[model samples]
Target: MREMNYFIVGDVHGCYYTLKKLLQNWDSDRQKLIFVGDYINKGKHSRKVVELVRELQYRYPGTVCIKGNHEYEMVRYIEDGTKNSDIKENFRNTLMDYDLRNKYRDDVKWMKRLPLYYDDGDIYVTHAGVNWLGLRKFKENSSWCVLRYRGRLKRMSRLQVFGHTPTESKRPEFNKKSNAINIDSGAGNFDNMSAVLIDDAGKIRKIYTEQIRKEDYH
Candidate 1:
């Protein structure tokens, strides 16, 4: 059997066209697609972005979509009916998109079930990198670490790839000492969406990006 490569995507906050262009680099037959999440909000096409991601997941059996902090906030808002201003503000765009499209219940249910991380032995993918305490402690009590962790991460046995805090350089940042990478290029904000290709051994092979299209973000 041939070794499967992985295309780990960064935070995609409703940059539908940008993500579409980025996936042009993906080889579905040889590469597993993994999205770090935040598929909605902060952009104009949240509905289209979620629909496209859902379609991709259905078409690709190897696709993995991890939960993100934005997803957590939206889920909490929907389920708990929170009056928290921050959550409301963060979720407003997504809510408006869903309302306009008349699709929310099913997608919210799907988001509610999203996993916090993906660990395939050699590579670990999550929305956010773990803290200095390491993955074991994170797995034991992962209230917010998996989806919201920031700053320096703990060195781990396997390479950890995550996307949550957008890199200041507008590019993916790799930390050799910790064996980790941050791929968030602020697709929902000022930068482009980015993804990294890695071999079965967890070696980064390439970086792919798509500049945010005005139609998708504006």
Candidate 2:
């Protein structure tokens, strides 16, 4: 069995350029890249975003991926909603093309089928944080995701890495738990963007693209 040296990335949010830039900076032909999801939304190139992810996943077999809230919501809007979602401007603006919009719906349904977590015998990876309120009742296919997802997986014996709640605030007012780490860094907030890699020991290694592009967000 191979000891996992995973390189986990935060929410890409259609920042394909930045994501490509970050991957280049990482400069590793060896390390496995694990993505925590929210690969679309809040930025341009959502259609391009999923394609890249799929390409990489194909290139690297067994690369772990979990679906995020944005992905979950988009699928809901497509499969169950009576009309198009009227939430906000975010990344969907860039997906106005008919083909890309249809692609997003297909991608979302695909994302819905993804596993909620990945455990390589050392680190556990998830999209949103595990649920805390009803941890006992939580499962990978749980219907409620945004609110109580993290608390759901708190019982995992190993370190859990997740992205959803942005870690943009430097004050550290967010989760201080040693077991779970958040790396979203507001990339999908249409604000500051960041992603980090965690070692097998659950230590944070590097954070890329600390500064958000003014044009990408607003």
Candidate 3:
């Protein structure tokens, strides 16, 4: 296997320009880029962001992409044309980010294939934090467990890294007691996009980002 350093990026939303700026100096050969989902909605250029992520995975063999709630909604919309107004509104917003909203079936299929979580011994990457309240009852394949759980895990074996609930400071939140880290810096909410870099020993090296503002895009 190739020696690789993992860099997990939080929700990108549709901030394509900001994400592009953050990846300007990334090295695909020696590093693995893992995205903690929510790549669409709330900003512009959702299509480009998805395209870029797909391109990166193609170029880098070890790249990993986790599924987010937004993706789940997309899959539901495609499969059943769900009647939930909230889901419909969110999916519509996501589609509007792309010029070709009518042709998003392929993206829905791609999201459906994405794994909910990834485990690499030292660290665990998921879209949202695991349900600590019900470890014994937790189902690995449960969409609610992977996409909606929020609280910290009670007895996590490895360092849990995730991005779903945005931090108040618009930065990655780390709790040593729970051994959990939240990296969703609210990029979907028109804030900054953050990347958490970790080494083989499970040490977080740095957290960096490129800011996004609604005014600038407007």
Candidate 3 — which residues are off by over 4 angstroms? Answer: 1-3, 83-86, 97-102, 134-144, 213-217
Count: clashes, candidate 2: 12
Winner by lDDT: 1
Compute each candidate's TM-score over C-alphas.
0.91, 0.78, 0.88
Best by TM-score: 1
**TM-score of model 1 (CA atoms):** 0.91
| Per-residue lDDT of model 1, residues 1-218, tens digit only | 98799999998888888888899999999999999989888887778888888888898867999988787777767787655465557477567547522356788888878988899898988888887765453452354477877777878899999988888888898999999999999896848899999999989999987788888755
Clashing pairs in 1: none
Candidate 2 lDDT by residue in tens digits, 1-218: 54445677777787776677667655355467888888777676677778888888888876777777676666655665424466445534644642434645666557778666777677777777666553532353464453225333354567767777665472112244546677677766555555566665666666665455554555
Question: Residue 58 of model 3: what lDDT?
Answer: 88
Off by over 4 Å in 2: 1-4, 85-95, 98-106, 133-156, 168-176
lDDT of 3 at 200: 76
Q: Whose lDDT is higher: candidate 2's or candidate 3's?
A: 3
Give lDDT for model 1.
0.82
